[model samples]
Target: MSAALRADPLADDTIAAILAGYGGSQWEAIALVNRLLAQWQSNADVQGWQAPDGTPAPIAAALQAYLAAAATLPAWADAARIERAEELFFDMSMLSCSLLFCASLPECYVVPDLAGVLHVAGQLEAHCDYRVRSTAAMIFPVMMKGGLASPQGGGIAQILKVRLIHATIRHLIVRGNPAQAAGAAVPALDAPCRHLYDTLYNHGWDVPANGLPCNQEELAYTLLTFHYIFLRGLRRLGLGLAPQDEEAYLHAWNVVGHVLGIEDGLLTHDMAQAEASFAALQARGRQSPFLPDPRPALGAALMRAMQDQIPLRLLKPFPVLLTRYLCGDAARIDLALDQRVNLLSRALFGAGMGLARAIDSVVRLALPGFSICRMMTRIVGYQFTVKFLMNQTRPLKLPPALLNQVGHTVRAWGDDPKAPRWMNALEARLAGRKARRAAPGGQPC
Candidate 1:
């Protein structure tokens, strides 16, 4: 990461403007954060927004100004490429969910500095589900149809709120100064902050050592995890996209990075640039060891949470194995997933992977589109969707309307129009869905 990029956090503008507009009052800033939380929780539709109840006019105006500007598409944003990327994501469907849970998220925790911030703000070991769910909350909105382009799509609205949330985290952690760079160093280690809502106040962050919480460098790295790492995972599973498709996917997420207030220089458009940048940033982040070493605990908690979601005993180990497979030795070692799984799970996973690859190689000769690996991964993905995304008891903290939309999307993933009839039936039985829609894609093909 560049020194200038590392020095600046994204909150330097819009959020700063909002807080300053509120007269820089400590009580007012806190109130605004709380108010945003309340308003967002109750409202799913983001096409039109209103000032939250009891919002001071100045603060509300500042927020309105920020959203209006932040929600806009960049001058260079390509609508065609973005729509193509959306199509690719939709076609990938349930398999995308598997990659997200196993690849993108596990790799996210591999960054020491980012994990350190999560440690501070998230009692991650205890609230593992919240970490997973919250990540999905952003992802679902961003990838949903017209999520970024249309006013009706929730992506821009949710991303604007997330951008603010990042700034708010920095504000509270640094005691509203927002200038942690020049601050006196707090002691290196202190009691870990366990507060749920307010990881809100002092968590004894050594800003000189850690940079700012949710700094630009870290945010950019995370965008890579979702786009670059996810694509990389697809390749590892023998499901790589066409070059144009890959570039389109990267483009779509770079747009999201822009929305999240990440610097343009930090975003990469191709896999080669992405790999080099990701490696450089990971190396830079690791050079300064984040104390308390949050990666292992955070990794364990994430794996355990995921494992708990799968009912099939044999499949419980799949999340860890898939994560370790997608992320190589370096990340595997970092996350402490280097340990061996039970002999049976290992043997079965190893054999299953080999069979999938062998079958895919032969099948592709006759039907160039077929991939057993894709089917296998989609089945695993379906399990994650049903357990994590479709759980009625603890539905995503989305407005009722958006939650309904998400549920419909997940259910539709049960049918694959492109797959052979037999494969679709197998997918249905294995995924515990009733059956494919009688006519796939709503036509009698």
Candidate 2:
């Protein structure tokens, strides 16, 4: 085994313990999640659910036990820090959403193995819109509830549900798509992918107990994407957060990572650890033989889906532009978005961001409570989108039937012929602006 593989033997053991103690099997985990959802629907307290014969339901009992242990505030957890992080996060809601969708999600696809798994699972290419919305919905509950410690916090509940989903994916991939799980025919974008393939195939195979689909390393990569990459995107946008706020923000996600089953060794405590881990991972990824493909289609589709949230024709190109700017040139090239940003789009994006920064600076100086205003704006916008635009009620449910309906609706909307005409016109307008800017006197008239 490579030194990297040998260095973290405990991560594998930790994952095994987590799975075994929680529900023993993926199906059992799913059952637990269903029961939890049912309790939610009926407005019954999850901790109070009872099985037939007057005994505690096995799944509920197991999950409640896990939550009781996992959801507690760590000895290092700080309430004041968490409060500061929440304020910082809420104040930058729009930027956060942009980073989550455009930067963080696309970055995940850079790993060819992860990309292949998500693609085969119908989560990435097949139902991209629903995937994005579902992800955002899951995140919303957590952020709004103020981290994962509160008994009233939806984050704990939501993370638990997602944990079950991950387990199910692990089971399906290992059993049904063994070739993919073994990394056959998939490009290796990094040393980690190659290592993962070797571990799955060459190193002995055990199903559901010692071996699973998504392991600790992959989970850690995802956690980094959410916490590290999101912060990087904010910095690119010139949103400077206080050092304390940054550390506190990572602290909140560290707790979230714990509940999500990431091993403590892989979970970062502060920015220094996060940066070191991220750099090490990046170095590993650079050693992969995989050439980037499939990412362009995936990235483009993700940006297109955001048109629903942002209606203006002029603002259409900004998502792609911001993605390129924040994610850097290498990612832009890898994701097939390199050619998408023209001179006009770049100029417009720069001007718009500059204006936004100036406004934010003014708000910070003149109106001390401007963060609250931004938070309220985000809340109102979110409520409108969920309730009116999507015609879905709040506190979103992800039952199978509802998910199917959402996928179908989103696909139908994407297929509509009218969708591209507006986008085409928007592009044309942008091109015209570029042409005018290049004309005599460099004027836009």
Model 1 residue pairs with clashes? none
Per-residue alpha-carbon lDDT of model 1 for 1-445, expressed as tens digits?
A: 3432243344445556666667656556756656674455322434355686777676677666665666576787899989998888888999998888888888889888789888777778888888888888888878878888875577776777777778777766665546534454544335454454345465656677777778778888889999999999999988888889999999999998887888787889999999999898888887878877999999999888888877889878988888888898898999999877899998899899989999998888887767778888888888778877778888997766667767777777877766776777788888777885577445232
Supply the TM-score for candidate 1. 0.91
**What is the per-residue lDDT of model 2 for residues 1-445, given as tens digits with 9 covering 90 to 100?**
2212221222223223334456355445445455555443111233354433432355445555554554444676677776676666555544466577767888876655455445544536556766666676566555543535555445665676666556545534443332234332322222232322232322222332222345565577777888888887667655546677778888878877776767677888777789898777655654542323456677777766664455556666666776777778777877777664557757876876666566666865754433322332232233223432355444346544334433343322211121123332333253232111132432121
Best candidate according to lDDT: 1
Model 1: residues with Cα > 4 Å off, grouped in runs: 1-54, 180-183, 187-194, 197-200, 440-445
Q: How many Å off is the CA of 87 in candidate 1?
A: 0.7
Top-scoring candidate (TM-score): 1
Q: How far does residue 381 in candidate 2 sit from its true spot (Å)?
A: 8.5
